[model samples]
Target: MTEHGRPSAPSLFDHAVEEIRATEFRDDLVVREITAPAGVAPFSLAVAADIRPEVDGVDSPYGTGRFILLHDPDEPSAWGGPWRIVCFAQAPLEPEIGTDALLADVAWSWLVDALDSRAAAYHSASGTATKTLSKGFGSLAEEGDGAQIELRASWTPSGSLSPHIEAWAELVCMLGGLPPGSEGIAVLGSHRSTRG
Candidate 1:
């Protein structure tokens, strides 16, 4: 190599980065690259998105989320491969739904379903789904009560990342109450279950 005396050949990780950049997502989801966290891996990429319906005039988003890709060419033993995908999604929920004991389980299933629908191969998947209920008290009593569901997950991807990214985008849409491939059709309530 002319510079640094290192070979210039692109690595597999470089190709993965290109694939992620070229992938297209549904119009309802606004995605943009963000700074990835330090020390997670030798190579990393991060993206943040908001699930907002263009047809709807609502100023607030139904949900917001982040997707992070980490690659360790050394093949970290715990990752089972060179790549790992980390995801976090949060969406507002009706207070009653958030109080349901099954809410956490349902939220976790959404991610599993999203990856499966895309035929995204992965393993070592693990995560937690949390429901947060907020109630106004004291001087803030006028704000009323509200609730939300948050999903955090990490898994090792087995192949091309394009499908994985698309699946993640769909997961964000699903968390925001939009059905898979729905474009912009707004649903009355959360679409927390798999449609089959």
Candidate 2:
């Protein structure tokens, strides 16, 4: 080990971190470094991202997400590699759209599509998409119904790490209901068709 206890100076993990820092995301996305969860890997990094964070003390109505990169030189069997990327993204949705049976599948597909679009190579990907519906009760009855979609996924990543993070950021914005390449643009609303 090097003096720093790393296998070498500027280890692969360090390079990964640098790649993530240099990644470019949408102007509307606010990406901030956060504490990486301990005990998962010898080296790890994490970041939190929010779309349109806040304006005048009002929280963003878009969405929020987290990206975590873990590196274990041992090459964990499940990860299929020394590097693994885990992500979580959630967004509020129109109450009507939440009831759609295909929402979960579509949410998962978005993730795959984002990664493919960016040409990020990876394998051993697994994840789940969840939809939540809530209704106001009693004093809160006036609030009516609300819904949200959440996606959690992890995959072993190959090649340069920048594209993977970029894909993740894009996925977050997409879930927030923004079209591709929508940076710096104002969204009027999202339109969904009703099933009769």
Q: Any runs in candidate 2 off by more than 4 Å, and if so which?
A: 1-10, 55-59, 188-196
Candidate 1, residues 95-163, lDDT tens digits: the string is 777799998898888888888988999999999988888887799776567788889999999977988
Candidate 2: tens digits of C-alpha lDDT, residues 1-196: 6877766523778888988999888788889898999999989999989888775233256877899999988889989889899999988887878899999999999899989988999999999999988887899776677788899999999999988898888888888888686777774243321111
Candidate 1 residue 192 C-alpha distance from true site, Å: 16
- The root-mean-square deviation over C-alpha atoms between each candidate and the true structure, in angstroms, is 5.5, 4.3
What 10-residue stretch in candidate 2 is worst by lDDT? 187-196
Clashes of 1: 0
TM-score of each: 0.85, 0.88
Q: Which candidate achieves the best lDDT against the true structure?
A: 2
The C-alpha local distance difference test score for the whole of candidate 2 amounts to 0.83
In terms of TM-score, the best-performing candidate is 2
